[model samples]
Target chain A: MEFKRLNIVYGHYGTGKTNFTLNCASALAKRGERVTVVDLDIVNPYFRSSDYHEELKRLGIRLIAPISANTTLESPALPADVYSAFSEESGTVFFDVGGDDAGAYALGRYSEQILKSESWQALFVVNKFRSLIALPGDAVSLMREIEAASHVPVTGIVNNSHVAEFTTPEDVLAGYAYAKEVGAFAGLPLAATAVPARFADSLQDKIENIMPVEVLVNLPWNAGK
Target chain B: MSERVLMKGNEALAEAAIRNGCRHFFGYPITPQTELAAYMSKRMPKIGGTYLQAESEIAAANMVLGAASAGVRAMTSSSSPGISLKTEAISYMCGSDLPCLIVNVQRGGPGLGGIQASQADYWQATKAPGHGDLHILVFAPCSVQEMVDLVGKAFALADQYRMPAMILADGMLGQMMEPVVLCEPGEVQMVEKPWAVTGHGGRRPHNIVNSLFLTPDELERTVKERFERYRKIEKTEALAENYMTDDADYVIVSYGACARIAKSAVLAAREKGVKVGLVRPLTLWPFPKQDLIKAAEHAKEFLCVEMSMGQMVDDVRLAISCSRPVSFFGHTGGIIPTPAEILAEIEKMAGGNA
Candidate 1:
């Protein structure tokens, strides 16, 4: 896998964007990098990177998240520390974007900073298994939607297609062509193929830039794998 | 249908409604249920269906009333406060004997509460959705798949009974992602609505869809007739899941998201040799008193768990005629009660009785 100084991850709501962002943050921190995650998708009440503020901190990551989340006043108010993602410049920073165009609208305010950043790659995650983006064209259109909303152009494509915990190496392989098609459609590179960590070794030779993933943003009640 | 796909509960319900032939969706965007309306906004236009993001929840409900009166499957969904706005129209829809699907993906509430999961709307759905002697068929789904399944079931049953049906989901179920298989057997027969205001021409008499029977006796007659339908629903439509309750001493009663947590607690209690099981009601309005009463014959006590302070506990107590002690354990204001906390409550009840 390649590392950029700043990574902007965006996708349709159920396309596993938050999971990938959290995984990348944890991976970067584990590599002894000073990692900070800008949780810009405050509108999403559940399964956002901000929900893992404690978990991210435990993993030696700094999180600039929404202030009034889960409170009586759940306004999508970003913290003042959000600007530090670009200003600090010492470590890797990731923008865990909101799900869709509506979610991406929040990032429009920080477009100038995001554009001025030295090295940033907006990763458009595509899940073929998800309902809306079952086609490569749909995936590319959503990428454009996010880009239009945030005033930020997407730079890469991530094939994060899976059927939740029931994902298989074959499922990951089956979605490879769809990912490549999406990348081709968007004129972008296939940034990474997110393979479930358990099946990553078996699928190592089959896929390039294999980013092994684990299920983290799961409901507490849905405990078993 | 064969391949399961990961879908948020809101999206699944919206898709399920479309699959069940509900071509009209009118709603206002409200968390954590905005996804459902968003889904409809994207899909309905493509499928030649009507998807109107109304100016307000009141407007949305009125649009649904309009759609249903045309003898079409129609739906409207909202969160707690938005649902409150729609309640007046819900009452009118019931008064007119219109069939439609109303979805309340509940958030914490007394007024404009936080955007998080809470089952506080139990009484609102079951006892009084609006006013008058009216009871909308309320379906409480426990899982994302169940939420999808209930959309079809609710629509079919609503048409069959000529009354509105509600899917009383909380934010947890609305926002959570799960692998779901959309199942629409499409076998259930819908009763014909000859009374629908479909605009009969000069050849036939015009049908009027009105709630105002100005004369008290006429209103009373309609109310009694609606009650007769309610009695039939109570007799036939109550749905419940009895998990490991065949010989359990302590039975846990729950519905919707609380049922999922309570089932987990029941499993944990069983590991400690606690004779505990769960009775989860799928239909909250029908109340499933028969299952509760059946459990009471064998179980010595019952525990009612909820995300609210404890509204459903009263229904549980009433259901079993207080034959056994019905205790309540809950958390309110968008806080979900954990399995451990419920197990602790069950253990205390188990020991207190012993």
Candidate 2:
């Protein structure tokens, strides 16, 4: 449950990986711990953690993204600043990676330095509600592909499943069961199950190792609320 | 009515497809619209349906063509650029008179656009889905519940007309989560496809499904007949929703996700006694022209709001026939116009400082 020096979060699209990573970085910074989030998501243009640069900066958390992230240009060029994340001496660095194997390939380029680094955890985030990995077998297979592409072993599984704003306590618990099966099949430990802060208390008795999260990302259509 | 469950718009549309007896789904993965394919991949196997992740959008669309030709309910979906790739096969379906559903969870476009919400494909969906003088039925849904309802309707309309029908949604509608009441299991009334290619068996003449006509006269006759059907649909199937248009001076014309924001602005303007209202087009192709003409009776001017750079404005102008001055306001490439921004425009249209 304690913070790792380098935390790499990976998952399929719409698995709430970016939201989870943003919340994780914010929590660490709030705890008086130095934090930096490397926006390794070159695949997606919208809803990346880098889109929240101003908000993250106000929270004293650094975000280093690709050169053209959140821009009109679909550039695949990774920034050289990502190299500094691995070399940082005293802060907890989180790699908010892009969704599937294609996104994980970017992390493969840094495999040499990551292998020689100190304590780190490559966490595979799973949301059972998302397609492709709804089944335990599918989630395990996707984890294998992510590991193969990144050249980093997935040390843990993080159950961060919810159906956007319509998520219920039951949905979170159901995702916990699904994530547990995925962890068992992949032989990975369950790091934590995330629930929205509002429903955390209601779900406490049903699940263990709960990480309460606040939804940070919002599309333009959802601006009024 | 079924119990309401919170669902993503994409997942809800997939489940609705299943409920309506759509057993064959062919798709290629693209952002904003991938969840629908993912949902089908999981549920289709359990229900004895075919869920294939095709090699490309072109292949997937052709697969839909094959499945639909065999008398099965079939569909394919993609985002903006992916939809562009599928246009060729869609045109083939239109010419062959194949009934199928095509879902376009539109994103910012013109090229390999951003995977954000946009309504920039209105012209593409309404005017030119493919080459040739063809028109397919296009439905626009504003909410997750509407997505579920409209997908079933899209399949039915496709079959009834024996032409491709589209559910035109933006990335925002596809990705957003909201409570929705999925149709009760087995509630849908299935359409019978007697004209399908199931083999002759010496019982009847052999049926051929194709878009090709080597002779120019044959192709011209086919095109003319299809337009006849489109004309009937234009008269009977054009759908729109009027909000606060009963007694208004200025009417705002919008659709899809942008209409939601425009409705909010309309309500805010009403609170300030601006006398503004909204006319939301539900069918983009058969395009509620008569309803706009009706709204034009009381309205002094029309303001078109969209996620694109005024794509729908031309249609609004055509509908009103330049009887009143038509103004435009929007943002392109996924920058959604806010309700406040829309209200400012409404204020400006009403002769007030923006």
Candidate 3:
């Protein structure tokens, strides 16, 4: 892939956006790029990027999360340090935006700085097996909703489809077709196809732009390999 | 083979209730459990069902009481503080002998505690769901799939027994995603509510659904009659799962989300040549006393693990008649104990440290 100075990831909740964001941040850090992950996901109290604060720090990725990320605030709370993402000049920054339009409303706060920099790409993650956004039309409409709420135009779509830990190769292949449909409907380019790292080798011959990700941000029972 | 789809516990509970013929859902959004209501709000309208977000938790519980009196399946969900507001309605439901599903996706509590998962409501659920001398059928499911399975059973048993049923879940199960094959209960054959307050159509005497008994004698009679049904339920409805307890020296007793952590710890202990097992309670109200008595015969020690500061330990002792040396290990105030911590506790118990 390509390295934009900043990358914004937004999608419907449970669409594997956080997992994809973590994968991207880890990959960027491994490639020796200074990476800072701003977790703007106040919509979901759990399973967000903030839950992996220690893990992210161990990977040399700085995280800017909500004030109530690891606390019991009973509401979504964001920190004021989000402005630093715009000021930092050397490393790649990734904003793990919230889920859906309701979640993306948080991203609207920093949309001005992101626009002024002119070095960012807002990617909408799409999943084929999710219940509410299973259809290509539903996915595009949600993308439109996020764009309208965040005031940041989504430039590309990331096809990160799976049934949680139950993802099969068949689901990833089918997701490529689904992502293409969503891209056509919304006139956005398919930027990447996210596959769990275990399935990356078998799918390399058949799939393109494969972003193999380690499954983090999960429960102990079904914590995938 | 049943094809499974990934679903959060809260979503699975909402979908399972819908499949079991629940048409009315009254809810006030609260954290962790809010997704269940969100799911209901999204799906209820599409199915021509009633999804009303009441003004407060009190209003939501009353709405369920009203819908349940009209002989329809109704449900309401909330966390700890919210569940506290609904307790009055729960007592009234018990007094009126009305059956409705009440889901408590619990968070830390005492008064408006934190939003993370906690089993602090065990006593509130099993001992006194309401003020009167009544017992609500309570189920504690440990997995997302079990959450789906028990929602149907909870609704069915509630209707059968003519009392409120609660799914005592916590934030961990509600937020975690897992693959669950939702039971497609096609064409739900609803149980007939002959004593319901449905319009009579002038064919027969109108049914009265009331909890008000003016005279003390009449109230006592009602209490005694409810106790008789409770006795039968206690005898027949207790459910527990015994994991590798056949020849074990130490047994861990847990329920709900804590049980999963306990099971993992038990496995680790067993791998180290320490004889250990887990006895998980599926029903909290019935308490599954017989299973504990059976385990007490072989296991020399028992450990009660919970998310709260050892709330379920007393029940374990009462179940086993204080036969074995029972130890309690837990964390309260929204802290979940890790498997290693629990395993360390097991090791201490194994070394006869208490």
Expressed as tens digits, the lDDT of each residue in B59-104 for candidate 1 is 9999999999999999999999998999999999999999999999
Model 2 lDDT, full chain set: 0.88
Off by over 4 Å in 2: A131-134, A177-189, A199-208, B1-67, B78-92, B107-117, B131-133, B143-145, B171-188, B210-228, B247-249, B267-275, B320-323
- lDDT scores in order: 0.88, 0.88, 0.88
Q: If scored against the real structure, what TM-score would every candidate get? A: 0.96, 0.85, 0.96
Q: By TM-score, how accurate is candidate 3?
A: 0.96
Model 3 is docked with a DockQ of: 0.44
Model 2: TM-score for chain B: 0.98
- Worst lDDT window (10 residues) for model 1 chain A? A216-225
Interface RMSD of each: 2.5, 3.8, 3.2
For every prediction, compared with the true complex, DockQ reads 0.55, 0.22, 0.44
Query: For candidate 2, what is the recovered fraction of reference interface contacts?
Result: 0.23
lDDT of 2 by residue, A30-138 (tens): 9988999998988766568888999899999988989987675777999998888977653999998888788899999998887788789889999877655778998
**Order by TM-score, highest first:** 3, 1, 2
